[model samples]
Target: DFPPLLISLGDLRRGFVFHEVKQVLITDEDIFKRYRERRQRWVGEEEKKIERWTELRGGDYVVHIDHGIGKFSGIKTLKLQGRKCDYFQVNYKGTDRLYIPLDQLDRLHKYMGDSDHPPPIYSLEGGQWRLTKRRVRKAARDLASSLLRLYSIRKVIPGYHFSLDTDWQLEFEASFPYQETPDQLRATHEVKQDMENPSPMDRLVCGDAGYGKTEVAMRAAFKVVMDNKQVAMLVPTTILAEQHHRTFRERIAAYPIRIEMLSRFQGLKEQKDIVTSLKNGGVDIVIGTHRLIQKDIEFKDLGLVIIDEEQRFGVIQKKKLRELRSSVDVLTLSATPIPRSLYMSLMGVRSMSMIVTPPKERLNVETQVAEYNEE
Candidate 1:
């Protein structure tokens, strides 16, 4: 739960599902009064200010005061008046730009995609986005406050009733074709171990693009589905979702499993049917992009959630993903290779698996780099 705070504290602390916080008898009047006062949460102008450490960092989104929606590219240190200050460089579309001083970060938002379309670009020269920044900031602050309260209550609640059983392990292994790669075997073992543990799993399987990461997820999903439970596989793109749907359908077809794909590209009726099947337990495996996170879709018995290429998801979707991690088994697949130094820093604390070896008996492709010549 503490580690999840690094991702999103609100997600880790959201309201309880089946349990509620138990109230304690007040023993001291002053302490009780102080607690009661703290309970009346409201975002004032001072409260709306984001702390220096809590400001958006690189990889977070920032709504430009002038230009509509631009990402927080990063902060650079600058020497000014014999002192150092940080400037946030925002990449606005079509040649517009905004440079926000570090101290003014309170005026910006850690862009959570509030609307379907990218927030329209306000005229930069007219300073429209800047004018609306305060209102946006206030809204974000209110959301944060609400999130904080919700999480506080959720932290005190107990977990779910349905627990994972181990009957599917045998069937899962039997369904595999082509001997498992050593790395794949290791990852499967890690996943199985996580499933058996009481503490929820938040493991990442980092592998090369074609290094059988999906196969590992398949093994886990098979286990969950075999337990008569539903599984959700969240991809980052529509193309990837379609590809996964085909791959999963082909792989799980050997067993008595029904897999479905959900996305905007599909017909409205088809999506509705698929969603209905998901809610009624007719669909065992669901594969889609972040569209799966929408409120309309509900799983009958979601035991596991497999997220592929999670780094590609937007911040808001990722936030919801974190919310799902508390009690559900979350197996993430990352194609981006982490540097050894950075991995070392996070090694023991975060559970991770790396697939470095190619499959045995597989021939390595011969490659050569030649200078590009325009002919």
Candidate 2:
């Protein structure tokens, strides 16, 4: 037996304890489990909200996985078999319309093609869509085979094996202001491991904008520079090249590494001097646009090539990159990767690391559409 505890009306009024408690719960395991399940469901719904089709409006082009490209006319509710059901209305060429039930919305995707010229809508008759898909599949297969052959050749050729990180590298990374996310750390580790191996590194780092993809590339560049090898950062446009040049300079300011930018913005004499410096190993890292691939530009010992927005490069520029792929380490960074890159990564032809975790306090981008007005 123990002394009796007094219960006060003040406690009950303040919600500290119940006035007349019949039963007391000992554990909250069930409540916690339910809370977790609800949280997961909320996350799933949020992801679905960001799907491309959610923003589809009337008159927008859409592609049906089985029916090819068509124009979205909007949703409609119509009576079918004595019952009313909601269906997606899609209009094809020459008054051809398709009604897809709401249950099959997963088969539709917003059309992503050239904005200036629309793709030809496939006819629903005569199996033309099937034939077109078959031809595309064959082309894709051939492309994959060629990519595999190229990757195999790259594996056989030995590349510059960079040593592990040094004291300076640690210090440089520690100077970063923000904490590194888990995905960023993992991607950095994988890149360094690839550099340490003798095989050439052809890894794709896919992440959204402002997700520290540049930080990963900078770390790799620092490692390569530590081993007395140069790094060439190729961008798609002059503006991008300039932006990267600024970023690299700011990040490596305390170090003795020399970074130069090559674009049409530089004077003729300055361009010649930069090119000379590259040939004589005066420059450690170079960030440039397609101008870097011109006949005159040369590097003393380029061990790493970082291509930003690789999909934006044209066929000719990419062809030149393919030639370099056999010898030097290549790292491609893209926020919106093209289908070829995705397929290559999936097929194991090239290594890939994804930085999916956004930074703390980072908010989702908001998009708004309005009619263009001169004012």
Best by lDDT: 2
Question: What lDDT tens digits, residue by residue, belong to model 1 across residues 280-363?
Answer: 999999999888999998988888999887767887997798678656777888877334312532665347888887776766
What lDDT score goes with residue 365 in model 1? 63
Candidate 2 achieves a global lDDT of 0.85
What TM-score would every model get versus the actual structure?
0.55, 0.66
RMSD of each: 16.4, 17.5
lDDT digits (tens) for residues 1-375 of candidate 2: 323553322101112334475433222433345344423433332122215445889988888766888899988898876778888899988888999877667667777768999888877777788788789879778766766677888878898889989999999999988899999999999999999999999999999998999999999999999999999999999999988999999999999999999997899999999999999999999999989999998889999999999889998898788777888999999998877787778888789999999989887887899999999
Clashing residue pairs in candidate 1 (N, C-alpha, C atoms within 3 angstroms):
13-151, 65-129, 65-130
